[model samples]
Target: MRGRQLRRAEICLLVTVAAVPVAACGSERETVERPTVPRGMDRQADSDADRLAAEKAALDAYAGYLAASRAASGRSDPHAPELSRFLADPLLTRVQMSILQAKEHGAMRTGTLKSDPTVTSVSLDSKPATVEIQDCLDATGYRLVYAKDRRVVPGSGGGRHLATATATRYPDGRWLISSGAAHQDQPC
Candidate 1:
């Protein structure tokens, strides 16, 4: 009878030990989930920031070009060295030609050409990154006057003009105006 009781006590001890573990595991609990990030996303974010900076630079260059044009218009020779700083080939040549024509016609601008530019679109994946800008030109107080007779030139009455420019980025990271067009007496 003593041995049987001892055996029964051992069985109870084992059962209690196992049951304790089972009871502990059986309790229900809520699990929390965490957000996971994919690899290389950080690098992509950096690339995007760089692309935006490049686009802004391009837009700035376009604005500089317009400013240069405005300055050149007021000069007797219509040749402003600062104009080349913002322009690249083809467009540079075109601007120079326009300046020369103005000088030959003895025309000089009498007022400021104010430009408010907005970036329309940008593409950074291309070999030469491209940026497009739309500009609202306020020439309401501006006029092109003949140097000799001081008469206002036809179509020189500046009110409002709409202009668009496409700029390109060089390898050295300098953005330059490549092509642009302007419409006189047009709304933005």
Candidate 2:
């Protein structure tokens, strides 16, 4: 009995010692604020808090993407470099292509684009983890117009509509808008 007890104690000590370095080396996303959680519940608190942070960051990235797109569209700039800051490859390519088409048609987007976005789902366990967002997009104060004369383009729309997006976490720890869609048919 004494020998078994000593072996268990040694194992526990080894585990505690091994855990210290691993804890210290946790990834940035795992770094949560020191919460007021009770001693044993710290892990739960940390996970919940980290999830909330990821949600907020994803929404922020969505806003950044919109703001950057608007800024570029207002100038009819197809090659607007700012879009890269908030967007990743395939979507980036598609968005730039859309802007190029708009510029080619001599049109520009102008005015305000307001959005109320919520995190619809979070998949932290997925490879490259992602957060899904649903937004009630209010573009009533915004418009697409002919650049040369500043006249509203026919069929250019503004209203409350549904929009959805997926925000993916990059290896570098930045959340970026990876995919999205605006639902013109579904009024919000």
For TM-score, the strongest prediction is: 2
Cα displacement (angstroms), candidate 2, residue 89, comes to 2.6
lDDT of 2 at 132: 97
lDDT per residue as tens, model 2, 1-188: 99999999999999999778867877434555543446768778778998999999998999999999999888878678889889987788888988889899999899999999999999998999999999999999899989999899999979999999899999999999989899989999
Q: Where is model 1 poorest over a 10-residue stretch in terms of lDDT?
A: 27-36
lDDT of 1 by residue, 1-188 (tens): 99999999999999999768645754433122323447798679888898789777987897788778777877854457888899987788888888788778888777777888888988888888888889898888788899888799997677887988889988887899989888864786
Clashing pairs in 1: none
Residue 167's lDDT within candidate 1 is 91
TM-score of 1: 0.73
Q: Give the distance in Å from residue 49's predicted Cα in candidate 2 to where it truly belongs.
A: 1.6
